[model samples]
Each structure stands twice: as C-alpha cells, then as structure tokens.
Target: MILGRDEANKALRAQHGQRGTQARRAAAASVIGTTIEWYDFFLYNTAAALIFPAVFFPESSSYAGAMQSFATYAVGFAARPVGAAIFGYWGDRIGRKTTLIITLLLMGIASGVIGVLPGTDSIGIVAPIMLVVLRLIQGIAVGGEWSGSVLLAMEWGDQRKRGLLASFAQMGVPMGLVLGTGGMTLLSALLPAESFTSWGWRIPFLASLVLVAVGLVIRLRILETPMFAAVVAERRTSSKPVTDAVKHHWREILLSAGLRFSEQMPFYLFTSFVLVYAVEERDLSKTFVLNAVLVAAAIELATIPLFSRLSDSIGRKRVYLSGAILVGALAFPYFAVLKDGSALAIFLIVIASMIPHAMQYGPQAALIGESFPTHLRYGGAGLGYQLASVFAGGPAPLLATWLLHSTGTPFSISAYIVFSAVVTVVCVIVLPDRSRADITDDNVYARTPGKHRTSS
Candidate 1:
C-alpha cells in the first residue's frame, strides 16, 4: 500500500524520537551501573581506612594494621587489569550489554559476601586472606566496568558529542564517592563507635545487592550500541581483542596508562590517602574528614560534566593538561591546609582540591576511548585505563603512609604527586587528540595516524 506524504513524515519523526529515547536510556544505564559498581568498590576503601585495620588485623600495631588493610585495598586494584582482559574479550565477542551485566553481578556478589565474612577476631589469619581475595574480585569487576560503561553511553549517541556522553559514565566515580562516603558518615554518626566498627560498615555492602538489582534492570533494557552491531555485521569482532591491541596498539595502550597517572594517582592521594592523613597524621575526626570528602565528591558531580562539555568546544588536551598541572600545584598546599586551617578554611580547601581531577576525569573517558577503532576500543581502552591501578592508584596510600612515618613531613608525598603530574603532562603532549576523529570508523587496522577510515 502507498502511504501519504504526511504519514511518511510522521513515521520518520516517530522513529527519530525512539532513537533519542534509546540513547538517553543507554546513557542513564551507564551512569547507574558505574555508580553502583564504584559505590561497592569505594566502600571497601572507606572500610580499609577505618574498620578493616582493627577488625581484621587485631594483633598488629596501629601503623602495621593500617598498612595491611591498604595492601588488601591495593589488591582490588591489582585485579582490575585481569577483569579488563576477561570482560573486554566478551565485550568485543558477545556484546557490551551482556559483558556489563556480568560485571555488575560479580561486584554486587563480592560486596555482599564481604559484608558477612568473619573478621580476624573470629576467623583468625584466614580473615585478612579472604578479604584480599574478595577485594581482588571487586577490582577485576570494576576494571571491566569503566570502558564498557563509557562505550555503552558514547556509542549510543552522536560520536561528535562523545565528550559529554562519555562524561555521563565518568560522573559515576564522584557520585560513587559521595554515596559511599556519605552513607558511611551518616551510619558512623548514628551508631555507637563500637557498633559501627562491628556491623555498620557492612550495611552498604549488603545494600549493594539492591543497587545492583536496579542497575541490572536498567542495563538489560538497553540494546547493544549501533557501532558494535555494525562490528558484528561486518564480521569484525575479535576473539583476542587484548592480544591484538597489545600487538598493534601497544603505543596507545602505554600512552593511555601514562596519561592516567596524574589523574588516578593524585585522585587516590586526594581522596583515600588524604583521609588517612587527616585522621592518623593530623588527629582529625574520621567523620570530619569523611564529610569533607563527601562534599568534594558532590561538587565534582557538577564540575565533571561542565569540564567535559567544555572539551567538546575547546579540545581534550588543553582541559586535561590544565588539570594535570594543577595536580602538581595543589600537592603541597592540599596538605598544609588540611593540617593548619580553621574549620571553614579546611572545608574550603577540601572542596577546592578536586576540580582539577574533575577536569581530567570528565574528558578522560572520551580521550582514551577515542584512541582506538570501535572494534578494538573495549580491549585497548580497558587495558590501558585499568593498568594505572597497578602503578598509580593501588600503591598511593601505602606509599603515602610510609612517607608520612619515615620523612615526618607531607612534602615527600607532595613531590611524588608532582612527579606523576609531570609524567602525565608528557603523555598528554605525545598522545594525539582524537576529539575530532571518526572513532565510529569500522576499519580496525587503518594505518592513518589518529582517525580510522575504510579505504575506498
């Protein structure tokens, strides 16, 4: 049957509306999935700083116990690269939606188990060992989560607006920090100190089951990204995405990880190490330091997307380098203000500190993910991004704790932050800005420098 012109126009408009709705839903799913995953992940960081040292290592000295707790925390980061390799393969082979679902379930299950696991006083040496194992699982799950979530969000929409769309997934980090830290603060405040140490910390972990459920519902509703669909249709999917990425895109993989040093290293310093500094070194209340972190994270939620949108107009490198440079600039002052400032002054400093990190983190998703073609993006981006956990973030707190004790000043730690910033600056300069590149190009083996395209 032949349709009228008006009917054809109406159907076209309806189809466009449906596509927009699908894009929005995919983006929302990315944000919620990452938020839930990071919520469970960062909650362990909070526990390591406040509860695990005492609960799982009861026989050790205060400093030693803290060190052990942080070691286990680092173990989670160490597991992320493995998760990246495993999930990145499935993401390329099967699809983004399915891979993401498995990661969410893995994370939620690990967290819930940690909540019920017996502590050292009850289970002896096995407690800390088991904690390490569970933390490892959490790390691997999140390792896969970042690139998949960002790709899910970015691929569903216009590739030109990738900076903003990717930032939707990036927002999950700060939002997770806020939710995890804020929940801990409120519970610790309400419960008796002993009770909080005993059981309050477990509440968030157990609640992750519910949050993960919500995330699954959102994620399951979305279809695979259009770009991935094309990859499958063209028979471009790889059985060994990571192996190929390392063999072919090794330079980008290394540069991507180097680019993360300033962002990830100093981020751990500002959030996790700084918490240790406030409570252990400066004798600040856990609640006070936590509140400061919660506030900083809340502020980041607004600023992260703003900077990401700004990158769409300017460029990724300028916004990113500015943030890297500031990481060095603020390294020392961040400690000084926390040590000597009045309540209002310290609050301001804590809140002011993370804007630079946000500047990098917001644009980072698109900048890194843009480095490779659609088919290889999952493996290449995931490996490069998660590798930073091994060298930068995973050891930050442990190193900071040692520096504080041995050097008797925060300056040593400040110098370390500056060094990382310098390394990142070099990487940002070397890595091509693919902000304007055609990442949707399905040519996985293109020889052209930054952007990929099929030869006519």
Candidate 2:
C-alpha cells in the first residue's frame, strides 16, 4: 500500500496531531495519578513530624522517639529501589498503564491500612513493625509510580512541549503536598487536640482510598501511550530491561541520581522536617509551620506549571540550571528566615524557597525521561529516580534532624542542601540537552544493536 510522498507527509502530520492530543490526555492522567500517590506519601510525612512519635513509638524519649519515627519514615525510601526494579521491569515489558495502575492500588491499600492500624498502645510491639512494613510497600509503589507517569506524559508529547507536559506531571508533588497538608490542617483546626491526635489523622489516610479510586477511574479511560504501544507492536520490548538500563545507561542513571540529590533533599527538609525544627528548635507553634508550608505549597502549585511552560520556549537545561544556582544561593537565607520565627518572615521565606523549587521541579520529569530510550525508559528512569531515595529523599529528614541536633546551628543544614545543589550543577553541565532530540527513534537501542551504549 505505497502512497505518494505528499500523501505520506499528510498522514504523518495527522498522526502527529493525534499524538499531540494523546499527549495532553496522558499528561492529565500523569498529574492526577502522581497527585494521589504523593497525597498519601506526604500525609505520612506530616504525621511523622507532628504525631507519629507519640502514637507509633510511645516508649522512647520525646526527641528519641521522633527520631525513631523519622527513621521508620526513611525505611520506605530504602525499599524504593527494590520496588523500582520489580515494577519498572513490568512497566517496560508489559505496559506503563498496567504498572501504574498496580502501583496506585498498592499505595492506596498501604495508606488505607495505615489509617486503620492499631497504635502502639493497642498493639504494643507489633504496631510500629506494621507501620514500617506498610511504609516499605509505599516506598516500592511510589518508587515506580513517578517514572511511569512521567514517561507516559513525555512519550506522548512533542519534543518542544515535552518539558511543559512533563512538568505538569511533576506539579502533582506540590498539589499533593497542598492537599495532604491542607487536609491535616483543616482536621487539626476543627478537632480538639485530643480528638485530632486520637482520630483526626486517620481521616486523611482513609481519604486516600477515595482519591485512588478516582485516579484509577480516570487512568482506565486513557489508552496506552502511542510510543509504548509502538514498542509492543514492533516487539522491541527489552527482555532484560533492568540489566540493559544499568549496563548501557549507567552514567545517565548516576547523573540523574545526583541531579535528584539537591531537589529531594531540600524539599523534605523544607516541607517535612521543618515542622519539627520550628516547634522544637525555634519554639514556634505547629500551626504556624503548617500554615507556612501550606502557603509555600500553594505558591508552588501555580509556579511549577508556569516554569514548565517557560521551559518550552527557553531550553530545559537553562531553566533547570538557573533553579539549581538559585537554590544554592538561597539555602542559607531560607533558614535564616526561619530563625526569626515571625509569621511574616516564615511566610516570605517559604514563598521564596518554593519559587526556586518549582522552577527546578517543573522541568525535571521531562529532562530525566529524555535521558533514556523507550524500551528501557521505564526501568532506566525508575531505577535512577528510586536509587536516589536512599541518599536523597530517604535520608533527608534523618540527616536534617541529626545536623540540627549535632551542630545546634541551623546553618549546618543549609550546608547540606548547598552540597546537593553543587552535585546537581555538575551533573547538569555534563548531560546533553535532549529537548530537541528525536526520542521516539534516536535512542541508545536504536543506535547500538547488540551492545547498548547511549550516545550523548
């Protein structure tokens, strides 16, 4: 069924138009799915900061117990890479949609379980252990969730708008953070402290089950991404996707892990650990910190998409690099603002901090997804992202706590975030800008036949 060149061109254009529509749809799904996953994740983090120590690990000293609870919080991050490997393989081999759905369900069940689980007073030694177990499941589920959702959005989008679309997916983080914190804040305010501690926390976790169901329904309506479908139809699925990702894309993986180090570390520091730091170190009320976070997260929700769209006109690297540099410079100032303990100062600092965070976070998904090929894209991105959980996301809160306790100076924490930004700056300089690269065809596997090495 040969056609004229003009006819072929026309057909290609039509296909591209359809792909554009699909990309938009996929991006919407990615945003929704990621929001649900992070809502559950952030709710736990908020609880850990405000309530978990007393509720889950009741026997230790107040400070020791909080540290212990945070340690358990880190356990999920430790298990992330393992989950990434397991689900990432399935995402690449079977389908991104299927793997995403499975991850969402896993996270929903874990969150729901946490909502209903008996506390240490009721279950004694078994309660914290169960909490840790559920956290591990969450780590695994969410480890795979981000890569799948981002890849779906990136694969469907045009090269020019990839950053914008990808950022939309990433925007889910701030959105989820806002929702999670807002829900807790509302509950905390409405219920008396006694009732809030006793039962209000459970409402947010239970609410996740309903959100997950909504996410599942929206996701089920969308078709598998055209790019992944093409891979399946051509029988190009990697039999050893994880190994191939490691052997071929190891450098990208390392760079990505390092690139993520700055963002995730500072993020948890600012959002999760800051609540405890403010209350314990600065003597500010919990409500003040929560309100500050809510303001920051709200600003981020609006700024993330704006920056992502801006990256489409400018380049991804330029936007991301600027963010890295900005955060590096502002790390010290941000903590200094918190030191003042005034509500206005806290609000201003939060807004300022979130701006740079949003700038980097917005384009991050497309940038990372563009680093690998379609066949191993899921495994490659998932492994790179999840591996960072150990050094970056998982250890952030613990390290911040340790730094504060050890140094008694908040600047010590600033130095840690600055170091992460430094690592990211170097990684960004080394990696090529793939904004205009033809990701659909020109990739590591397409260029190298038997041996798989991704060309820069």
Candidate 3:
C-alpha cells in the first residue's frame, strides 16, 4: 500500500530510534559481560597472592609457598594465548555473540569448580593438580572474552566515538578488580584470620556462578555485531581465522603485544605484588592493602572512560604514550611513597598508579581492535593481547618478587617498569593510529588510508 510522505518519515525515525536503543543495550551488555569475566579471572589473582600459598601448596617457607602459588597463577596466563587462538578462530568463523557465550560458560564453571575443590591437605597431589587445571580453564575463557567483548561494543557504535564506546568494555577490568578485591576484603573483615583463609576465599569463586548467569542473560539479548554480520552476509568468513591472522597480520600482532607491556606489567606490579609488598615488607595489615586496592579500583571506574573520551578527541597513540611516560616517570616515586608505610601514603600511591593505568587501558580496546581488519580482528587482536600475559602480566609479580629478593630494593623493580615503558613507547610509535579508520573496509590494510599498512 502506498503511504504518505509524512508516515514514511515517521516510520524511518522510529526505526532509527530502535537501532539506537539496541546499540546502547549492546554496549551495556558488553561491559557487564567483560566485568564478570575479569571478576572471575582477577579473583584468582587476589586469592593467589593472599590465600592460595597457605591453602593450596605444601608446607614450606612463606616465600616458597608464595612463589608456588604465583606459579599456579601464572599457569592461567600460559593458557591465555592458546585460548585466544582457539576461540578467536571460532569467533571469526562463526560469530562474536556465540563465541562469547561459550567463553562465559567456560569461565563460570571453572571458577565454581575451584570453589568446591579439595585443598592440598584433603587430596594431597590431586588437589593442586585440579586447581591448576581449573585455572587453565579460567585463563582460556578470559582469553576469548576480552576481544569479543571489545568488538561487540566497538562494532555496534559510531566509529567516531569508537574509543569511548570500546572503553566501556575496558571499564570491566577495574570493575572486576573491585568486585574481586572487595569480596575478599569484606570476607576477611567478617571472618577471623584462620577461618578466612580456610574457606572464605572459596565464597567468591562460588559466587561466580550467580554473576555468570546474569552475564549470560545480558549477552544473549544482544545482537551480533554489524561488522561480523556484514562478513557473513557477504560470505566472507575466514575458514581459518587464526592461520590467516598469523600469516598476514603477524607484524600487527607483534607490535600490539609489545604495546601492552607497559600496561600489563605495571598493573600486576601495582595490584598483586603490592599486596604482598605492603603486608610483608612494610608490615602493613592485609586489610589496609586490600582497602587501598579497593579505593584505587573505584577511582579507575571513573578515570578509564574519562581518558578514553580524551582519546576520542586527541588520538589513541598520544593518550596511550602519555600514560606510558607517566608509568616510567612514576615508577621510583611509587615505591618510595609506598615505603613510607603509612596507610594514607600507600592509598595515595595506589590511586596514582591507577590514573596512569586507566589512561592506557581505557583506549586499549580500540587501539588493538583497530589494528587489524574486521575479518581477522578477533584472532589478531586476541592473540596479540593475550600473548602479553605470558611475557608481561603473568610474570609480573613473580619478577617483582625476584627483583626484590635479589637486589633487596625496589630500584630494580623501577628499572623493570622503565624497560617495559620504553618497549611500549617504541611499539606505540610504530603502530598506526586507526581511531578514524573506516571499519566497514574489510581490507583494512590494503585499501585503507592510514598511517601504517601491512599485507592482509
């Protein structure tokens, strides 16, 4: 039936409004899903630093036990790149939404299982073995989760605001850190010390089941990203996304991995290692360090998006470079301030550290996602991002501990931070600024007019 011009215009407006609503909902779901995933992931990190040494490892010197627990924590990161390859393939071949559901389910089950598993005393060699296995599953799950979540948010938004939009998913990291640390803080405060270490840490792991259920519901409601949809509609899905990424986009992947050094290294140093440093070296109470972490994470919830929005205005590279510089510049001061042993001083250091962290992290999702074409993005970005876990994030606390034990000072650790910062600055300088790229271009490198180019 023929319609009046005014009726047609009205219908068009209504359809546009619905699309806007869907886009916003998709962004929110992406954020919530990533937050839950990271909560499950970081929960394990917190437990490793504070509780696992005693509960999961055999009796040993305090330092030895702590080292063993951190070794297990590092195992999770060892699985991340493998997860990135496996999930990235499916995410690129099938669809982003479906891949996310599988990852979320994997993570939730792993975390809940860890909560129920027997400790070393109960099962001898079996307990720690099972714990490492579950940690591996958690690692794999999050390996897939980050790339898909960031793509889910970025692919649905206006390209002009992609930095700000993708940063929503990045916000989940701090949110998860808060939830994970806060849960431990609250549990530690409520229970006596002996009881807290015995079973309290498991509560947060079990609670993962509930949060996972909520994340699944939100994720299920969102539509697949338009970019992936376009690929499917054009029958252009990669048969082997992981292979294609490696074959064609290896340079981008390498640079992307290097770019993460500054961000990942400092994060673990600030969050996980500091917990041990404050408690052991400075003789601060566990609660004080935990509370300081909580406050810093809360501040990041605001700052991540703020810096991300800044990236939308200035450029992703400039904002990210500024953050790397701050990290290097503040490395020594960070330790010096914390060494004062005052709760207020540690609190200030924690907050100061996160400000530089959020600046880099806030724009990181967009920066990496934009590095490769849409078809190869899931695999390329995930591989690049997760690879950093092995050399950077996973080894951070262990490295810091070794540095302190050997040198007997934080100066060595400061040098480590500066080295990572230099690596990131070099990478950021080499990596192209694609904040303004036309994501609709399937051949991102070949035809796209950008600062840098690689064969794809």
lDDT, candidate 3, 1-456, per-residue tens:
111234334433433465577578778888899889989988999899998888888686888888888889999998999999999988887678789999999999999999999889998989899999999999999898889988988887778999999998898998999999999999999999999988888999999999999998988787677677666555556677788888878888999999999999999989999989899988888888888889999999999999999999999999999999999999999998877646787888888899999989999999999988877789989999999999999999988888888899988999999999999999999998988878777555863223222222
Model 1 lDDT tens row, 1-456:
111234334333433566688788889999999999999988999989999988999888998988998999999999999999988877776778889999999999999999999999898899888899999899989999999999988988877788999999998999889999888999999999999999989999899999999999999887777777766655556666677778778888899999999999888877887777788766888899899889999999999999999999899999999999998899889778877877677778888889999999999999999987777788889999999999999999999888888998888888999999999999999998989877876443354234322211
- Model 2 weakest lDDT span, ten residues long: 1-10
lDDT per residue (tens digit) for residues 265-375 in model 2 = 888888988889888877877777888899899888888888888877887889988998888999999888888657688777876888888888888888888888887
Q: Sort the candidates on lDDT, descending order.
A: 3, 1, 2
lDDT of each: 0.86, 0.84, 0.86
Model 3: C-alpha RMSD to truth?
Answer: 5.4
Model 1 steric clash pairs: none
Q: Estimate each model's TM-score.
A: 0.94, 0.93, 0.94
- Selected candidate, larger lDDT, 1 vs 2: 1
TM-score, candidate 3, is 0.94
Between candidates 2 and 3, the one scoring higher on TM-score is 3
